[model samples]
Target: MGRNRKWIQICILLAVVILGGWTIASSVLDKTEIPKVGSKAPEFTLTGLDGKTHQLSDYKGKTVVVNFWATYCPPCREEMPDIQKQAAKWADKDVVVLGVNVAESKVTAKNFVDQLGVTFPILLDSKDKIRREYGVLNYPTTVFVKPDGKIAVIKEGLMDEAYLDRTIASVAAAGNGNK
Candidate 1:
């Protein structure tokens, strides 16, 4: 009986260790496994407020800014104007700003955009499918894609006009490098 009890304890301890190791490994992998800066940005197709579907692949050869935001998020609301301004700054260039609204209704997103006077395309991610694909866990996450479809940067949180301009400039510089 004593030997049996000891064996059972050993088995339980081994199971705990194995489970703990797997949990830790998975979390570490998630943290370090974000999309690479120079790798191809993940492609997604979502409908905009105008009822037109927009695909990332469609914007190939154009520098695209994919910003994942929600209408109710304060930081997301704050950064919308800056994103709009930055997009306008590069209007003549081959650049497009896409604002992806995560898990928000079209009516809400449309109202918010109209209220803010946003001129850029606002894509709807009603189910948050695209948001999950982009690994955007925070509000106002911005992913800058270079003209070659490669990712230039992924910024998480509220972005000011200066930061957005700097990031756009970096993408432009990266685009020049590819040429």
Candidate 2:
């Protein structure tokens, strides 16, 4: 009985050690160093669902909402409609919303966009190069870029329409003042 109890204790200790190590590794992998606010936004060129190349410099004189998302992320899906609504609100303004789909096929991204009925442009990052450039470790990360091509804000997870609108407004205000 004593030998059996000792064996069980050893097994439990080994299991705990293994589980703890996995948890630490998982956290480390998910950890990302997001760009600081007011820093110049990283430049990247990706192909859009429309088959046209899109470079960050294309919208140099506009405030852009660059969002990194995936089809499987629930929070990303949840914020799609809000983002669409905000896009329409800022349509006449110098604001553009670019949805960057990370590591997904054109077909999958097209299906998702069709299902959502979104009018905004969805760019495909099949190689995850753009995502890596932006340092996105989360499913739904957003970066607000100013007219000068600098990052104004980096929001992780789902963002509300009100907050998005406020960020756009702030960027627009700053852009106008710079003129």
Minimum summed lDDT over a 10-residue window in model 2 is located at 29-38
Q: Return the TM-score for each candidate structure.
A: 0.80, 0.79
The sequence of per-residue lDDT tens digits that candidate 2 reaches over residues 1-179 is 99999999999999999999899998986675456788789888888999999999999999999999999999999999999999999988989999999998889899998899888889999999878878889989999998998888889999989988888899889987887
Cα lDDT of model 1 by residue, 1-179, tens digit:
99999999999999999999999989987673457688789888899998999999999988899999888899999988888888899888888999999998889999999999999999999988888777788898899999889898988998999988888888988897888
- The reply for model 1, stretches above 4 Å from the true place, is 1-34
lDDT of 2 at 127: 97
